[model samples]
Target: MCISRRNESLNVAGTMRRGVCLAGCALLCAFSACTMGPNFDAPPAPRAERIEHGEPVADVMDAAGAAQRFSNDATLSRDWWTTFGSAAVDRAVTDALVANPTLASAQAALRESEDDMRAGAGVFYPQIDASFGASRQKYSPLRVGSGQPPVIFNLFTLSAQVSYALDIWGGERRSLEALRAQTDAQRHALAAAYLTLSANVVNTMIAYAAYGDEIAATREMIALVGEQVSVTHSQFTAGVAAYSAVLTLENEKATLEATVPALEQRREQAGNLLAALSGSMPSQWIAPEVSLENIVLPAVLPRAVSSELVRQRPDIRQAEAALHVASARIGVATANLFPSVTLTAGGGYGNRSMNALLSQTGQAWSAAADVTAPLFHGGTLWFERRAAIDAYDQARAVYDQVVLAAFEQVADTLRALENDAHTLDADARALATSEEALRLVQAEYEAGTVGYLSILVADAQRHQARIAWLQGVAQRLQDTVALYAALGGGWYGNADG
Candidate 1:
């Protein structure tokens, strides 16, 4: 039978012959099963040194130091500013979070990067679209069937289409990985910015507090010196003291008077900075007044441990993430070497007559698939791959530098903590000695047995010793803060998760 012969030929051509279409499908299946690029693997973690120098090389403070340990929580929190334990500091931080312009800008950047990452991921899926259109055409009336009109009827078409580039080589997947890494990098970046902002807020507050304290102290000193100067003038006029001595006393009073304005100016500058951090008016918000008497160091401070630092430092994490992004880019570049298959399919129905619009006989459909392979391009793809390699190398270098810097920071902070402990002890001793000497000199001056210069020198020594003691305390506090920063903790509120 003719029907049976046609069926036999159809089966032979489609099944026995297995032409290019079938072969292409098989090849595509193979491609889909095999990724063309390298698989991503994380780099080895760095081996860090165990002990930092100057960390009680002897066994004296072993028990004291061992009681405190740094945390290894992967995610730091939003309220790191409360570590200072000051309500005013808490309020200031809240204000900054709410209104600080720089933070707002950084937040916007984070959001943009997050959206970009989402978009990059979304592209991996198949794209689908639906469209509808209608049109009318005109024909030459004289040439068309001799009895036909000049105008042609309207036709309408509606259809849905879908297309997807098979990510056979994991090219798109790697691109998504790169985007994900970028998102985390931005997250870490935002964390670093927040940390810096908190530090600035605290530093400004500390400066303001110290400046105010110094101003009050200087004012008292000035008033006392002025009184001393008046008393000395009376003694000189009464022939009890030399005129030159009164002039010297007057000069000292004048110098003390000058310090008041300088301290006030510093206080004002600190206030302005605090205002900026709080994103509020300097005059309206009172900078929380603090003093050496009020500051309470942690009962025990956590020591810097290398393992803890590497795991917690936002900067180091950010650098590592950058490396990830770069590594993914190599995959992206390698993927470009393979061929691309773009599947485009669009089908629609059209009918000139309104009554035939719903008829299957008048419907039309179409589908197509395209494959493109790069033949030659002056080695542009090669250069792109090379550039990707270069970027990976650069990221590696930056990661190396960041980790090295972290180690160095811890080492230096350890050295500073050791030295500052000694400095505080020495300053304490010096202050005590100066105070005793000042008391003895004042007694001798009241008895008229010592020269004014002796009393003046003793007073100067006491004042200098007092100021140095306060400054040393402030330095130690700041140094301690820095030590915690090096350890990647402390200013971080104690809420570890």
Candidate 2:
């Protein structure tokens, strides 16, 4: 009867122990689901549909003969630079993307962020580790008042340990969330780098071509002025013109010649920039001969609404990711205010002899659950939470500022395009009128109806008009490039490509 009663008591104790374990597990799970701090939501897109408050972008057409059309519904190609229709430009951009060290650095940073996040994820699983050790130790029972003899022994141990810090308040989870957001920020940074690099390459190419064109036009002006100088000298020799008239023509020719060197210097600088962009020394690579006339301006430019612009720009996206990280950090800080629970289990074999370490007689094991709660920290935890909140607010403000800046840039580029077209149209008309006047003056001079001075004035006016026209053409092309860049260079659609 006593044996049966003892057996029943043992069964009751076992049931109670099982109940305690089950209750502990249930508590852990329930607490783990409660994540601290405010959840994050993306800011709403701007309400204004139009990028600019003024006239519709679509109505603004290029009036300089080649009408540039803006299409709201058209999709921008990922390889937007290709729209310029220059194979050399396409090749340059491709080479830059492949070989630029800055791009490679950004890519490497992105990979590092991803790897860090992966490592942080390990906290979600139990960490298991195995270890082996051997040590010589001396033991004395006299230290504990047992009055036994001291003994020296060699100890051998082999063990496996498992531990997991319960994410009861979601601190570790929030940390992981922050890491993931950081990874996202890195990804956007890489995109921003790619966009910036391509735009720089194209802009440098355009500048190089424009400078070349301007130099050629200046040389033509110099030649025209030289001819006038010869005419004035002949008139002076015939005693029909003053010496000052010849001097004036000579001065004009010298001024026009002076400009060529400066223009040549600018052209060389642009070429060197192109070589650098292509990840090569100027000595190793020469910029291709990309003429202003060869570059085909894109006719149909893609125009995105304000909402889409927010989504498309890498800077905006990166700002958003930063906001996300800040939000997650707030959670992490809040969770820090609560208790952390860590569960550990260890099983080992130990013996004086290495061969006997694995024997059942030498077996040992342990299991424990530790709970550490912050009782007081001199307001450190509380202030940290406040700091995280401040950081989140700061990130949110930065995000708003970034969005505003992006809109401002797009609006400004759009206006510049419209103005460029108008300026180009006016400059073309001016050039034509000046050319006609010069032609008439030359005819009159040949017929002996006008003096060489009249021809000189007309030629100078035509030269000025030609320079203005060339500038207008280059400006229009550059503004077109700006519009493409302002629209985020279609990196979103062409990220993989």
Candidate 3:
């Protein structure tokens, strides 16, 4: 009989172990079940070899006479501003990245999203809570059909409870997924902010330098014209020329002088903008002097194909992340239409006497499983699911628009760079011709072979040509900066490190 009883106990123990194993397998299978929405796939990139459709982005012989080549497979550096070879430009970018309020706001947003995602992840695990209580109660047993006297008693309770809302339809998981995608979008947004701030700083600096150069060129022209006015005034006094000649030269000088204040104003505005970008008050900050001569045109500009640009550009990536978030929201809404399961278990000690609360007789335990199914919600769940689907469609459309805009911007910059090269070449030649003509005319006047009016006409032409050439140089540099920006400013490298 003892042997038979021991064998039966062994069989019962085996059955219990098998039951536990089966329960564990069932839980695992439930967790691995379908997530209730269409999985997201990234939109395929455009099937083009180059960004621009017409002539390839060719080497630009810019105003500085440097050949700026667009390399299809060049590794773009994170600190692209440094490629300008100006320490001042690099310093300004670094300072802006560190202190710009816009960038700081983006960083804070990213951190908040990340924290929310992490907090959302806790739903996958059981929620455990502990509680302790002490209270005085009056009990009346007569209500339970017993004629016992009413008694007042002290009750003490200590308990721990655990509850978990199982993600049977993956609603919670999908919610967490949406949070993660939103975090990703914010990260890309931060990158876009960095790109924009750096590009703005560099472009503004370029303008400041160009305006200063133009001001200098105008002053030199004014001096030359003033010299002519002195000579013409002497000639008028000697009765060798009309007084109108002196008036004409003086008028030209005054017109040239009038442009100086305007140029100075623009230069000051650019400086103030730079100070703001660097997170300093304009009155408290002075921008470093950046000369066009000190700025180096990038020799080999990095170019990405259409397929690569979608991935490189932060705006495109942010759009993709938004699409992902919308897709996940659809799953969450769809999951809400189905039943949700929750498992709860609690154990506690309770007693009228505080010292007896820990006794086995006072110990109690309970377990429960609950299933909540949506029955009648006035079609709210159904309409919500449809709305999520519509939102996903909207996100997809927006993503397509962002991608198209990115490609267009890149194409426009490429064309601008190419045209800038041709334009600068023409301007340089024009300036050179004007200078030669002025020199020749001045020499002829000294040799008594040409009239003073000839020199005046030549000087005016030289002044216009000089201004044009300076503008061309500045435009080429700024457009080079634009190309870098259009290519996403190499933020990926910075993000990785």
Candidate 4:
């Protein structure tokens, strides 16, 4: 009964010791939980409230019946390409988003950065390991002056150990912050990729339409020149017009014809570019026929505030994220100036005989604390910390540059559209006057009141006016598309979805 009581008493003492150990560990954790370093703060806003340029005019006077206006309250949809209301453009953008390797690459990079952040979070927990070993070795007691014989013995050891680095300096936290910021940067990069890809697809489609218009205009001019050549030949054969007039008509026809092949080649090149942007070979993809007439210009364009522009632009957001990462790295560097603390604990059971490995008498345990601090590294750490600060400053400058560029893009697009509207209006007027002049010259030539040269000049002027009008219309449409792209492609809040 006394032996049983003694064993119970030993058990109580062992439990008390373990309880004390756990309590001490808890106290240490509570005391060392604070991290040392500068906490992160968001960068300040720009001093200016509005953009450098004045606000654009509300409505533009277009030659076509469709007039476009700007509205400060207008908001762009997530799929801004759809605003053009062209099924072909929508399909091209959709297909590119699904199959473009560049977007897939960006997505993979974002996943990798997120995984790296997750891995860094592990620094908050303890590292635990279990080990087991068995060995046969010879030992001599004679070295201890016991005069014991040398003997071979079998030994076994089993242990589980845990070690934890206390984040008293907040180095791990700052490192994790940097990693998380990188993940954020990658996410923004992916959004930027999406924006770029969609814009390319839309821009390529617009160019294809422009090329088609030019080709059509060239064909019309060729037909008109052919008619003039036929008239000139008939008059020359009848001796009513000089042979030199016939020759001039023929030469003019040849000049107009020469432009057709170049226009066709340009059209084909634009088509090939569209195919490439769609992630298919030119031979495999059939580019859709597009024209400015089929595209609906957004009646009311969205013009965001300058500050909102900074928030919406993906490249600018990406640059800001990079700056955030640099700032966090400064904290990490500063934390390195402090000492690191680690706690270790281990327990094991062992015996020469495998059957007695778990015996109560064969158990062993240990606990320890350690500290390490860098004494010197030739000023590397100090300079690195300064370098981190400098890098952050650089990132901030780059972010500002990106914002400025984004605003510039919007301004350029707006001015182009405004100028295009005025040009289109003038082109329409010129074309009408040229057509009227051509009709009067044709009547006069038939009535023998004017020479064949007068008809040719009128026809050539009218053809040029027609081509100029087509080009002006196409340019206006392209600038409308550019405005959409400049405004962040309407993807600020919807990229993750």
Candidate 3, residue 372: lDDT:
90
Q: Give the clash total for candidate 2.
A: 0
**Model 2 lowest lDDT segment of ten:** 488-497
Evaluate residue 214 in candidate 2 and report its C-alpha lDDT on the 0 to 100 scale: 92
Off by over 4 Å in 2: 1-32, 439-460, 494-497
- Least accurate stretch of 10 residues (summed lDDT) in model 4? 43-52
Alpha-carbon runs more than 4 Å astray in model 4? 1-35, 47-61, 134-156, 353-356, 438-460, 493-497
Pitting candidate 2 against candidate 4, the one with the higher TM-score is 2
Candidate 1 lDDT tens digits, 1-497: 99999999999888856777756854885556555345555455566555465344221212212222233332233554455566766766677667787888778888998999989988778898987777897876787558766777787777778898877666788898888888878877776777777767766666666776667666666666776777777788889889998888789879888888888898899888878877778777677767755654433455455655666677887897898999888988977877777887876666776667667876767678888887898999989999998999999899989988988887776666566666777787898998899899989989999866576567666766777666666666666566656655532334321
Candidate 3 wrong stretches, greater than 4 Å:
1-32, 53-64, 142-149, 445-460, 493-497
- The model with the greater TM-score, 3 or 4, is 3
Candidate 1 whole-model C-alpha lDDT, 0 to 1: 0.71
Clashing pairs in 2: none
lDDT of each structure? 0.71, 0.87, 0.88, 0.81
* Candidate scoring better on lDDT of 1 and 2: 2
TM-scores for all predictions: 0.82, 0.90, 0.89, 0.85
Q: What is candidate 4's lDDT per residue for 114-136, written digit by digit as tens?
A: 99999999988999999999999
Q: Clashing pairs in model 1?
A: none
Clashing pairs in 4: 36-169
TM-score of 4: 0.85
The residue ranges of model 1 lying beyond 4 angstroms of the native Cα positions read 1-32, 36-45, 50-83, 139-151, 353-357, 439-460, 490-497
